[model samples]
Target: MPNHTLVNNIDHKDTKIITERSAAYGDDIWFTQTFPAEYRSVQAYYPIFFTKDENTGRFFSVALFGFQQNENLFIKDNRWSVPYIPLTHARTPFLIGEQALMEDGIEKHQRVLFLDEDHPRVNTEQGEPLFLEFGANAPYLESMADMMEVLHHGIEDHNAFIDMLVELELLESFTLDVELNDRSQHQMLGFYTINEDKLAALSSEVIAKLHQNGHLQPIYMTLASQSNVTRLIQLKNAQLGL
Candidate 1:
């Protein structure tokens, strides 16, 4: 799984919607200041972590399903919120309210949730935490197989997923208008230029390998709305000069 690095400053915008993996537990909380009506996707199924602990052989997992946002500006109970707001959307366990925190001294940051140290159940033989995790959207701009490669393993070996291109026939291409986090935006950042020469050079040995492995396609798309995710991938692939 892709390892995560601390993003010290918010202005840098270094973080992308990524799939992270680790053997130890972690506490990473992200908050949103603006909630547009069209963007309820803030509550997408957050990718959880799976860590194996040899000390206790127990599988433990937790998911949040509710949200509570506090907008009361007058009292301590509502200090964490912006102020004078109504809780319009709270479908899942995503609580939008501001919670209390200890006063250390100088630097301060938001605290979302704290996980327990020990597992409740331990297997008779060994003590370990069996971890299992699932994420829907394949949040990468490259090819689908390439996307999985980077997510599961930090580096990708292109030779593995190359066969997917055989089944990936010619699909019409189009231009997209992308709006950046800043007011600036770009339209048609690039185009999907497929190499017919590469397709024609397929060898019999390569064909046999592809037949054995079977064809694969993307399971999930990652656009604001997934409707244009495939198209976006093609655009990115073209821009990359692949």
Candidate 2:
């Protein structure tokens, strides 16, 4: 379980975070949540798919890195092999939390930064420092704050986009079957993808609405990203040396 606590410079001035990408630091995830704003970059290197949360049953988008669980093929030589990492993956050890603040004598909740003390990347020595010598945020911390801000808005957009997709009945469940060069086979299930037939069958007015609302491109981007599945198979074959 993650031990999350509010971050303050005074109490955590000496905190450092390991920025390296490696399985040792828990980068061995097969997929991570993504949003439409990131689809352009994510589609270039990953296959974007929709999945439902087991607990909430809410649908969300993800960038697939591998065919199975805990099999991240993008980690190479203790580093991310790709140029762009999904913001959800890049913003580690830090997450957005709510803080109550007084505004005109009324208490209001505001988004604040929270740190996961139990994360493997967190430490007091080595790696990127979170605070400078004089209780100010370091460059790495600043960047993380910016990332969290982007993620906050991205999640909002993601929710609205998913609602639109669900309303239009554009999502469909899918199962992916993979065969490795060593003759080993695997099946990936419980994921969803866009229903192209439904999308095409949508009325022109509906299509125009999607385009006007800035979702049509991402829908197409998700479709385009499926091609990267072939690349993933190649990587798996290379990893298996067959």
Candidate 3:
């Protein structure tokens, strides 16, 4: 279970978060949730794919890190091998939470930063400090706040983006079967990708709508990112010494 609490300097003034990237800090993840705004950067190094939540059936984008569950091929020597790490993974132990606020005598809910006290990254000493002398936020904490803000808006837009894809019936089931340099075979199931054929069949008017609404670029980016699967396979083969 997670013990998450609102990050207050008064209560957690001496707390420090592990800035190091390692499996101990929960960095051994095969994929992380991503958004359309990040496809350009994320697609460059990792294969972008869509997955659904079995409980809610909500579609979400992810950046792949490995071929199998809980395998992060990018981690070596306690470091992330890739230059670009997904924001969702980098923001571990801290997430945006809703809180009530009073403004102009009106009560409203707003997103606030919350830290998981029980997470492996949280500790009384070592790594980045959450606060400085006189209880001011540390530089890393300020960056996390900015990241949470961007993630909040990005996720809000992702819902509409998914809705548009559903309306257009552009999502289609996909399966990836691969044989590494070794004799081992792997099959990936229960994932979805953009239907290029259906995308090409869209009428000009609809295509223009997607283009004007900033969805077209991400669609193409996703398509382009499929090429990076070859890179991922190579990484896997290297890991297997195949």
Candidate 4:
């Protein structure tokens, strides 16, 4: 496969960074971006993943870039915006489990690895998220579809998450799937309506835990009606005989 180009203008002579700072093993590169203010919930520690394409093969990389602002989750990096999901994490930490488990006769609750205990649970910090991404012998078009699905799951599984929150009492009975002005946005769907009063009373740590586990964006995009990378193939097919 003459490798469909995935990443372009990679300054590292086409070599990009993985899990943050791909400039070089010796180069201290810290990737950062600034996100919109409307999205207040994103944590700085959220890792961004990427992929590279060459004539012989394709590769993927995961990065945990830093944000200049202490208050937002967005990055200043031109190539690594929060929204782009790389094919590297086709199998993300966004695991779907049947139920909780026990370890050595004691309850073994598997916290989503994204959680950062050092941060004030809710104060304003998400600990350095563990970044792990790998490559495989696959093309971007197919690989990206699977990666996007995982991202979609992370965003749209709101109701299922709300159910989990109720089971955990992270919120005193929450509702979800609320849709917004745009059908693609939340207002059109349901909402995780917390008992407003009870919700306010909860601790920040408890709240942060919920945000970390929500996987909000991943699921939303996965199930979203608008995003369609497949359209590219269709357009190309039309020009095939040209």
Best by lDDT: 2
- Candidate 3 is scored at a TM of 0.97
- The models' CA-based lDDT, in order, is 0.26, 0.94, 0.90, 0.31
Question: Per-residue alpha-carbon lDDT of model 1 for 174-241, expressed as tens digits?
Answer: 35455433434445422232233554466778656655653221111112223433433333344345
TM-scores of the candidates in the order shown: 0.20, 0.97, 0.97, 0.21
Q: How much is the lDDT of residue 141 in candidate 2? A: 89
Supply candidate 4's per-residue lDDT for 52: 29
Per-residue lDDT for 1-242 in model 3, tens only? 98989998998899998887788889888889999888888998998899998899999999998888888888988788878888888888999999998999999998889999999999997989989989999998999999888888888888889999999999999999988998788899988999989999999999999999999999999999989989989999998887
After superposition on all C-alphas, the RMSD of every candidate to the true structure, in Å, is 21.3, 1.0, 1.0, 19.1
lDDT of 4 at 221: 25
* Candidate 2 lDDT, 1-242, residue by residue in tens: 99998888987899999999999998999999999999999999999999989999999999999988899999999899989999998998899988899999999998899999999999998899989999989999899999999999999999999999999999999899988888999899999999999999999999999999999999999999999999999999999887
Please list the residue runs of candidate 1 whose C-alpha ends up more than 4 Å from where it truly belongs after superposition. 1-158, 163-174, 178-185, 191-211, 219-242
Flag regions of model 4 displaced more than 4 Å.
1-44, 47-73, 81-138, 155-158, 172-242
RMSD of 3: 1.0
